[model samples]
Target: MILLQANQVARHFGGETLFQHINLEIKDKSRIALIGRNGAGKSTLLKMLAGEEEPDEGTITRTKNLSFGYLAQHTGLTSQKTVWEEVVSVFESVHAIESQMRELEKLISLESEKGNHADSNNYLEQYAALQQTFLDSNGYGIESEIKSVLHGFRFFESFYDQPVNTLSGGQKTRLALAKLLLEKPDLLILDEPTNHLDIDTLNWLEDYLQGYRGAILIVSHDRYFLDKIVTEVYELSRHQIYHYTGNYSRYLELKAAQQEQEWKAYDKQQAEIAKLEDFIARNLVRASTTKRAQSRRKKLEKMTRLDKPAGDEKSAKFLFQAERQSGRDVLAIEQAAIGYDDTVLSEPVTLHLRKQEAVALIGPNGIGKSTLLKSVTGQIPFLKGAAKLGQNVDIGYYDQEQANLTSRNTVLEELWQEHPTFPEKDIRTVLGAFLFSGEDVKKTIPLLSGGEKARVALAKLSMQKDNLLLLDEPTNHLDLDSKEVLEEALIDYDGTLLFVSHDRYFINRIATSVLELSENGSKLYHGDYDYYLEKKKEEQEVAEMTASKTEAEIPAASSAKRDFQQDKEHQRQKRSLEREIAALEEQLTNIDTHIAELQKQMEQPENLEDHEALTELNNQLTAQMEEQDAVMAEWEEKSLLYEDTY
Candidate 1:
């Protein structure tokens, strides 16, 4: 069923049409992505769909009583309640039903005491109906569900009781998202949902959204996230929206093909039109050929004209170049700790980056990825140990916050002031290459958006001819198109790179090696993000295997005498897994016995008469059932492993 539809929608701002005649459908459980360059009206279109903004022309039709939720790019939760309280508020209906259920229980008891059997039966009926509603709404599992979502967004128990008003902007945004997920709206609209998420949380969200019951209409610049979750893509460009049936990568392919076919058809039609016009002009004066010319002109006039294909929108253009090569070792950090004011974020870290190596530094937010970059650039003093630059290494840094930019200077003046010796025209040309032209060049730095500032920073960095570039979240404000442009430039850059970014797609594209920073220390993975994940998973499996062996109560005699130590290790692991499986099955059996007892209690007439006792027992039963399921799952997994090992 089509949950929502926009018919011939159009939006205008400042007498300029942002988009017109836009039509799309949000069908039941639809997974659609809206993509475009910055300023292409994606957010405006999203707002229209979300009913937060009205279209200048045409109509938006949503199903009657359809629940809608919108999460804007910077939406934050501001409340006096604690984080848990704020999130649980989304389930106000469930809470209301629960309260009514309790009230009904009291009335039912009062009527029973008064021997008003009819009144008691009516109250019991109402209470029973309300109880079913509560169950359907997941009232019993509300706390567990909230905790699952909070955990996915990297919120721990310690943060749950924190006042929502006291949280940081990012945390507030995350909390808003968590609440939205709990609400389970029929139509969920997310604008740049990946904005404040780290890689781990991004992965969790992708998994969560894939199984979301409601339709999702999202506008995001994160290609990887879009690819993972969305099955259909809508490219909003040149005052229109074009639908493409695929993920972002597949959309690129189809879009390219469609553009090529469109251009070809247009070119062929133009050629035929030109030929007919030329024939008409040459033959109209002649007696014998005049009839033919007139016929051709009539045919040409009747033919439908095709508009030119939309592609090749203005995009940022720049490149990274090195004036000189650095030594074999581009940069080295030995036993270094990075932090400020007597604080250390990481243990003594050691890393050696070679010439022309692009290394990505990744970790959770606030674990000091940015601090390490600043320490490397000498913008901040290292807390401990030595950070050394190889011979003849000239460094260029792109601050994620764009802090180094002079706020009062115009875009042109910013670049011009950096290289005063360069001609004004040349500076303007460079600015134009970065998509700053005409009036845009005159915009003061402070007035420019984050993306514009990033471009100005990039333009400046492109000119520096440095042997090493230390970037902090270089892709932060860049749109998908601009990010691709930057990725291509970096791919071709001969200089060494040591940058910190939360964009997994960008890291996968640009990084030759992965440096994982943690509280323990820095560990190097000798591959891209995918390879890093593969290695990480393998290590986890090994760790689990070792843990099972250590936790097992297996006797030494269970391992067969082996000629090789590896054989002994294998036999030992097999025996240990067998023991674990047996233990899980035994636990499952006990849980089943407990569940049976609870069921017996629930079926008792006397127990059912006591609402409070019944409710408490029901909650416990639900928890026990959930625990049993976990145990059963563990048993199945362990059984499979045992079979494979034996």
Candidate 2:
């Protein structure tokens, strides 16, 4: 069934047409993605479709009483209720039915206590009917369902009691999305849903949305995320919507072919026009061919000329280069500890990056991945060992926050100020290469959006010509096209790289090695993100297999003459596993109770205004989750080994 439709939709800004002749249709269980470059008016059109704004022309229609949920980018939930209350508020109908069921229970009990079987039977039937309604509405497993979703968003059970108002902006955005999911509307409209999510959470969300019951219309720049969830793509470009019947990658393929065909048809018509014009010009003045010339002129006048084919939006153009090559062993870090003040987030992290190598730094949130990069750049003091640069290594840093930028300076002046000796034309040329032309160059840094600021930072980075670059979350605010351009620049860059990024697609294209950080240290996997995951899974399997190796300790143990030494070793291994299992069980029990305590606190209405308390609680919860993963892994390993011994 068609859930919504927009007919001849047109939108205008001021007096100019932003987009016109736009037609859209959304059906039940549709998975559509809206994609375009920045400033293509994708968000504006989404607002129109979502009924948050009305089109200046045309009309939008929806099914009667059609339900939908709209989640704008970076829009966080603001509520005084605890997380549990806020999410559970979606089930008010279920709650109302529960009240009815409870009242029925009271009447049934009253009659039963009086030994009046006839009256009790009527109340019992009402109770049974109400209970079935509750079950059908998913009232019974609410807590477990909440737990699964909360865990997927990294909320865990503890944060269930945390007031929705007290969460960090990112956390609140996640909660807003969580509440929307619980509502289970017939249509879901999400803009940039992947903004604040990590790889794990992104993975979880991809899985969740794949199984989502309602139709989804999303606007996001994460190509990987789009590829996984969306079945159709709508590209808003050149004041129009172009629909393609596939995912993002497939859309690219079809778009290229379509563009090629358009250009070809236009070129063919232009050639025919040129021939006709030449004939008319040459023969119009000649007496012998006057009739033929007039006929050609009439035909030319009647021809409906094809308009020139438009191309994609203007894209930034720049390349990263190195002035000089660094010596072998571009950078080396041994036993380095990085953190702020007294906190040692991670220690004994080692990396030996050779010349022209690209490495991706990855870790959980708050594990000090950024701190490690900063320590190398001398922005922070190392808590333990130092990062020694190899001979002639020059570092260029791209901070995600763009802090090093001259915010007060205009885009033109920001580049000009950096290289004052260069000519104005030369500076403008470079700025223009980054799509900051004309008056755009005069805009101050503070006025530029996140994507524009990112371009400015990248423009400066491209100019530095440094032999080594340390980038932190380099793809944070970039659109898909800009990210691809940057990826191309970095791929051809004649430098070494050690950058922190959560963009798995970017990492997959750029990284020669993956460095995973932990509290104790960092480990290097000699591959891309996917390969790193493969190696990590293999490590787990290997750990499991190590347990089954006790039989190999003594060949005769499987048969008759097992020596005392062999028996002793087996017993010792069994005893050690037993002790480890007992400790793990205790740790697991304690962590579970801690989580329950947080949930209890979340249940309290008083936590609604306690922002600082919630922040502290979140920090503790992160540690507990990390500990829980480790403990679970260890316990599973030991338990398997213990079973093999028997």
- Candidate achieving the largest lDDT: 1
Q: What is candidate 2's CA lDDT for residue 462?
A: 85
Residues 1-646 of candidate 2 have per-residue lDDT tens digits of 9999989899888988888888888999999999888878888988988999999999999999999999998799999999988888888999899999989888998999999999999889888888999999999888788778888888977888888888999999988998899889999999998887777789899999999999999999888889899999988888888899999989999999999999999999999999999999999999999899999989989999988989767888868998755654578899888899979999889998877779999987778999999999999999999999976689999999999898789999988888999999998899888898899999999999999999999899888899999999998888889999999989999789999988888999999999999898999887799999898899999778766668664464445686779999999999998998898878876876676576557556666468887777767777876776677678767866797896
User: TM-score for all predictions?
Assistant: 0.83, 0.82
What C-alpha lDDT values do all the predictions have?
0.88, 0.88
In candidate 1, which residue pairs get closer than 3 Å at backbone N, Cα or C atoms, i.e. clash?
Answer: none
Q: Which stretches of candidate 1 lie over 4 Å from their true place?
A: 107-119, 274-294, 550-646
User: Model 1, 226-252: lDDT tens per residue?
Assistant: 989899998888888899998999999
Model 2: colliding residue pairs? 161-602, 161-603, 162-602
Model 1 whole-model lDDT (C-alpha atoms): 0.88
Question: How large is the C-alpha RMSD of every model relative to the true structure?
Answer: 21.8, 16.9
